[model samples]
Target: MCNQTTTAEKSSPTHIYFDSPEKHCRGTDYLCCSISDIISEAKSLFNLAFPIALTGLILYSRSIVSMLFLGYLGDIELAAGSLAIAFANITGYSVLSGLALGMDPLCSQAFGAQRHKLLSLTLHRYVVFLLFTSIFISFLWINMFNIMVYLQQDHNITRIGQRYLLFSLLDLFTNSFVHPIRIYLRAQGITRPVALASFFGTFLHLPISFVLVSHFNFGVSGVAASASISNFFVLISLVAYIWVSGIHEPTWEKPSFECLTGWKSLLKLAVPSCVLVCLEWWWYEIMIVMCGLLVNPKALVASMGILIQTTSLLYVFPSSLGFAVSTRVGNELGANRPYKARLSVAVAMFISAIMGLSALTFATALRDKWALMFTSDTQILRLTSVALPILGLCELGNCPQTVGCGVLRGSARPSTAANVNLGAFYLVGMPVAVGSVFYIGIGFSGLWLGLLSAQVCCAGLMLYVVESTDWEQQAKRARMLTCIDIRQPDDFDCNKGEVEQPLTCSA
Candidate 1:
């Protein structure tokens, strides 16, 4: 309660307002700032950037290390692991990750509107729902893992893969709770906890993994158990924080089913977000499958293992930026400050683009060295060397597209993001790129051609959508849903006196 903002007291739901910068500057007279002000602004930005960047690295550290550790586990295991992770990441991330997204816009808007009283119950109930759904999905994934092995062909690799799958299944259930907890903290502008927790998890994970896999000779299962152990610890940490730290709690009035009743709105956003995630994830899985068909599958798989690790690690930056965009933009918009929302979008996109290009440069330079880090397979290394340049180039588009979708999520326009990805990646990008391998005899390089085309086009379309959005119009939509009376410039806003967004429907 001590951290509560003054805006929480306002009674008008439709008229909830963001803190006016004009009023905020009264003491400092922000109309103009001295050189010290510029320094202060930079410092503030740095404060924000460091934690988010560090958080990104910590969160992704596991995947990066896994690629290194597992790549040496042999080609079959390596290939199997890459394909498995891709499949799980795509299907699991889409379903589970998309569900967690409901909190960003909802919770940020609540905080910005000074509706702190609404948070506790929402957070609690949402967690329960997420945990249940994630468990179901985990079981499903485990089954699919078994099916993939039994149906394909019996080999030493498949047997070992089953062990990996079993371990991965356990880890998934534990980590599923992580996203919601992290999102809840970010929504309340309390990010340091999650970041710190991630750092601890990653740090603790490495030693345990090394010990189990090497000292104890647990091998694949050992590595897998370590991951599960780390995730379980992190989940416990989050729960402890929520209970002991007296975090903001949304009310559940008489168990009125507000969350379920209101989930239609959430679903509108979740479905498209899921689609966007699935499209990319599935394609990467296809990439692994493609590697298997090549002359030296072992080298091909290991090189790609390195490549994916590189991309996944870099992806964390844009992901955090996207998270920032959704939180900042949704909060400002919900508080009826369209201008601030626009500014937030601009800030996120610019940073994302810069990070993307930077990642591409590193990927290009380190492509060869990366493959060698895994194994000395000359053939695989050569294939990876050939593919790295193109993959590196794709980052420019991939990063923006990632942030672009995040922007749309903030705008509560996930459907738009989903459509663009489907059209660009599936309809346009994948077919041409994948087909070129056989059709044009370009091999795996041709497959990448399809990928880059889709991602770039998707990114462009996302940017256009962001540009076309009128925040003023968004503010009106926010008001109608919350049932608050806010100022109306034209009194003929897009909602046009309607009670909800036109797209709002049962999921």
Candidate 2:
């Protein structure tokens, strides 16, 4: 039989930390759930936040450095590494990662409910689901390099990109395994496992990068090799953590179909969540291609690359808050307290916005120093300095938007997010952005304008959605908070219930 498991047939695999799902209680005094506990939770959240941000910095910085290091091997390798990363991140990594983010909210709700019964069942089947996705995505990378060449990237670039893709594809394990493993740990209120794991991964990255690039003469392959090595170690670290904690197979006497049913619930939020990410990543891939066609194109691409990357690095903090908020909100909703979910989201968004402002201030203060830390090109620095402040403003919009998406995710309503992103990025944001860049002749500032505009639109929609969220409805929706699908058929016999609905979806 083909290994595709349907909602009915899929069973949740058992793990060590899974508390029985049957014991979940409804109608608790969610307000009385201790302000001290909340503060302590927030404090623990802060501890995880910066570490996650550092991990992002280390991961992205390694890629930046690895590319520069491989450049010493030759321009072909350098160009190839860049091309491969763009292609896979767009089509494979970013595409697959949506499902990973999807896992966090579901796990959070489960953790909040303290329902171990459904724990292993949901995560177990999710692993199976992601394994299928990982396999397909891996094959796509292996098979699609030639198509990328046909897409008209330079020949030398294609060859180098292909070699890097071969190495980069190894993260199917990290993308598929590590994200869920870490998120599930977080759901258990255990931040240390992922914190320690990411640190371990980063620590492992340094020596492997040096040895492969400098010592072994592996060149670009060496950088890719280091990534593969680092990921393997990270995976091993997480698995070991889970194992020692007694959460995996050793304690499992059997599996439950309840968890399998839960996977569908998770998808109700996951699919739309993935679409939101795909839409965002897909557009940037286009922007990168278009930007590469401009005057002083390498500088344009490199300059924007530096700033775009810097935003992603700084993004780790708010992104962590978003994750924390999603978990908190989902847990609250699952426990039948929609109002607290609202308040918690407000608090998290405020905190994230403060963090965003600090990042912006830091970036602005150091804008002239780009020549030192982020890059060395005099022209690129000048270009980036002109652009960094706008990018700093871009952070202002991006901050709440990340948390907003997280809020929507907790409600099992990723479709609202998908449409919001679609409108903000594609309809409202990109047109004016590209036109501004090429037409107004402001160069890349137009692109930044477009991105900033999109971020604002997205933030506005997110705020509106959160404001309008009926916690009671979300509480009910939390019952299905495990699958990746988001579509629902409303009862409307021949279309005249006089109840006009807004766009409905649940990725």
TM-score of each candidate? Answer: 0.83, 0.81
Per-residue lDDT tens digits for candidate 2, residues 271-367, read 8878978887776666655665677655665565566567767787788787777777877776656656755765677686788788789788878
Reference-based lDDT, residue 447, model 2 = 85
Whole-structure CA lDDT of model 1: 0.66
The TM-score measured for candidate 1 stands at 0.83
Model 1 segments more than 4 A misplaced: 1-49, 145-156, 247-262, 486-507
Winning model by TM-score: 1
Q: How many backbone clashes does candidate 1 have?
A: 14
